[model samples]
Target: MTIERTEPATDAAERTMLEGWLDYHRNTLAWKCEGLSDEQLRTASVEPSELSLMGLVRHMAEVERGWFRKVLTNEDAPPIYYSDEDQDGEFHLTESDTYQEAFATWQAEIETARRNAARFALDDLSEGKHRRTGEQFNLRWIYTHMIEEYARHNGHADLIRERLDGSTGD
Candidate 1:
């Protein structure tokens, strides 16, 4: 299915601006993967890299869960697709994974992230520490980091989508 992207407003409050840009990037990822078959979605178009459109969807879902649910809300959310033994599972796809399910899970996680974020002000600090750095952070930092994360992954998505069908755009 095709996903429609809404451009961020040029002028807005800090919260609105952050959320709008994030939503734009999120939709861009979906648009990049839209209307493709399961095989197409799973194609590691950029050889030597394990990245795939489907894997990206899964990765973003995990990212949303981590920053929003786990860090922001201090919820005990586990990884959706990875483990210690398979830390990069989000970028690893098999024939058993379905694009429909990945998209649904990603969308759900997005909604959950929004709900979790709505509970706190931008300056509110997380109760949990960063997994790697062991440093605490605020909601504002999380929002900015998530935007950067999606922006970077969306670039990868653009390349993969183009390789799959020569399609390209914002």
Candidate 2:
């Protein structure tokens, strides 16, 4: 994944540490999607691959909901993109959606995540019993993991976008 310097263009400016790393990541993620019209962004790498840019957008939104809202807040909220019957629904891309539809949903979810994250103290803890191990976890772990999760998938998305077009770089 390309990381564009969020630094000010001039050398005289004193740069703050962690300056726009998160914003850089967010913009870089969006930058990978630049210049692709609706149809191209929604295109899949291969038929039946269950990997599409649109799906990644939705999946990341779901992840933010899962970690920041449900897990971080320890709410009993049901999984946003999960299904007990078929676990892979989150991976399935909706080709029928217009560009406006996909992006609008994504924008809404991103806002929700940001709002929830803003509400928490830095040391917030999750109160739920684990689904597999039946243990409790602090929200700290969930937040760290969410950052890692987004970074990792953002790498995957970079490659996908590269394949779509020659415009590559943060």
Candidate 3:
């Protein structure tokens, strides 16, 4: 079950470049989880930390929903796996959680994010305000931020995957 990742195009427009990098990072995360069982995916192989590949998948789904559906498009979207009471639930998995469900939700959120993003131009302002500062952001800023988020998390994913099975690559 090897996951296939596409390399970003060297020469492209701003949107194409941004999206290509983002998709690359996204697939990189999935690639890290490939060929692992549910328990393997949920293992906190990174000692002294609770981060797992499944947790990263869940976290990214929440991120996609939060930024795209909740903020960008102003949809009444709520956290998929976490709440105010359990803020880190996405990273706190149980035996009941399945990798299939987690991956499906993550993929669905990714698709929704793309659809929601299509409604606005790069310079268009988000319909919702930032939770911390109450300031609005443009779509371009959101895209850049999302790319950064994925890139950072994918690095974590790489470390975790390598620790799990001694596998490593871009």
lDDT of all the models against the reference? 0.91, 0.62, 0.90
* TM, every model: 0.96, 0.74, 0.96
Which candidate number would show the highest lDDT if scored against the true structure?
A: 1
Q: Kindly provide the TM-score of model 3 when superposed on the true structure, using C-alpha atoms.
A: 0.96
Those runs of model 1 whose alpha carbons end farther than 4 Å from true positions after fitting are: none
Per-residue accuracy of model 3 over 29-133 as CA lDDT, tens digit each:
888898999999999966689999999999999999989987898889888999999999999999999999999999999999889888999999999977778
TM-score of 1: 0.96
Candidate 3: worst-modelled 10 consecutive residues by lDDT: 1-10
CA RMSD (A), model 3: 1.1
For 44-139, candidate 2 gives per-residue lDDT tens digits of: 767668676766766776776666566656666565555898576656646576556655665676677667666655555564555677665564
Q: Write the per-residue lDDT of candidate 1 for residues 59-156, one digit (tens) a residue.
A: 99999999898888879998989999999988889899999999999999999999989988999998777788887789999999999999999999
Off by over 4 Å in 2: 1-20, 79-82
User: Which pairs clash in the backbone of model 2?
Assistant: 125-139, 126-139
